[model samples]
Target: MTIAKGDKIPAGKLRTLTADGPKDITTDEIFAGKTVVLFGLPGAFTPTCSAKHLPGFIEKFDALKAKGVDTIACVSVNDAFVMGAWGKSQDAGDKVLMLADGNADFAKSLGLDADFSAYGMGTRSKRFSLVAKDGVVTEVNVEAQGAFEVSTADHVLGQL
Candidate 1:
């Protein structure tokens, strides 16, 4: 079942890239008592994700933060190393939390997995974004393949 508005985030472990190395953080801890803006992409460094999707967030980080977003995260099925590298490549290293859902467990749990084995990328995350307050989702924007209609920072910022 797709996680919808009003749903509390499921508890799970996700890896975060830190200066000290990778750190395991619980989903609940991250979302608990905070307002977060999170977006998931199929993979790190993919064309759309690099060129536009993530840049949109990096560019508007301050505005989103001003609107009460405690954390702005970009997640993908890639591992911590890959996600870290991609963040550096995009010059977004300091701006966003680049989270790695290496196994797609989090995505699957949210019903956001997209199978792209045909394109040689196994299971991946559907392009989507959400706003959560104190662990409960308040707004969700999931996009169809190759579409960028709803997940833009501008759209979510407006929601806040």
Candidate 2:
């Protein structure tokens, strides 16, 4: 089922590129004790993702933090290296944690996986954002197919 408010985030492993190298992060490790705002996108370096989705989060990082958000993360089906490079290019730095769902396991678990085979991009995560507190979802903003309205950082901040 698609994740929703009151749902516990599915258990799975996600990857993040650290200074040393790629590191594993359990879903619990990310949301267990924090109010996390996580936004998942179709891919790294894609038009909408690069120009708006990711940048919006980076721009609103401080505002989200001011509202008691512990972490703002950007998750995508791309591998860690790509995620890292994109984060760097976008100046995400420590403001937005770039999590890689390389194999789409976590995305599938959330029932948020999409088929983009027509575009030659196999399975990818649908664009969405959710707020999780202590591993339980308090809010979810899933965009309609091919839409970017609801999942933007400004909209999410309004929800908060």
Candidate 3:
């Protein structure tokens, strides 16, 4: 089932690129004892994801942090290298955590995985954003297919 408000985030290993190399970050390591804003997209560097979805969060990072959000993360079903490159290209800097769910484990756990074979993208996560406090989701906004309304940073900030 799609994860909802009040549900505990499921366990999974996501990859993050570091200077040393790709590192595995567990779900508990991310959400434990903190308020996190996590947004997932279909893929990195896609038109909408690069043009709007990711930029919205990057632009609103400070506002979201001021609202007591500890971490802002962007997850996609791509390898760490691609995620890292995308982050750098977008000038994400230290503002947003770029997570690589390369195997779609996290997306599947949340029931957010969708097949994009028609687009030649294979399986990917739906566009969505959520607020998790101390490991439990407090709010979730899942966008409709091909829509960008609910999961925008402005909408997520309004929920804060």
lDDT of 2 by residue, 1-160 (tens): 8988899999989999998999999999999999999999999999999999999999998899999999999999999999999999999999999999999999999999999889999999999999999999998998998899999999999988
* Model 3: per-residue Cα lDDT over 47-140, one tens digit each: 9999999999999999999999999999999999999999999999999999999989899999899999999999999999999999999999
Candidate 2's C-alpha runs over 4 A off are: none
Arrange candidates by TM-score, highest first: which order?
Answer: 3, 2, 1
Residue 149, candidate 2: how far off, in angstroms?
A: 0.6
lDDT of each: 0.93, 0.95, 0.96
After aligning candidate 2 to the native by TM-score, how far in Å is the CA of 158 from where it should be?
A: 0.6
Candidates arranged by lDDT, highest first: 3, 2, 1
Each model's total of backbone clashes: 0, 0, 0
Q: Which candidate has the highest lDDT of all? A: 3
lDDT of model 3 at position 52: 98
Per-residue lDDT for 32-122 in model 1, tens only?
9999999999989888899889999999999998998999999999988899889999888667989999999999999999998998999
**What residue pairs are clashing in model 3?**
none
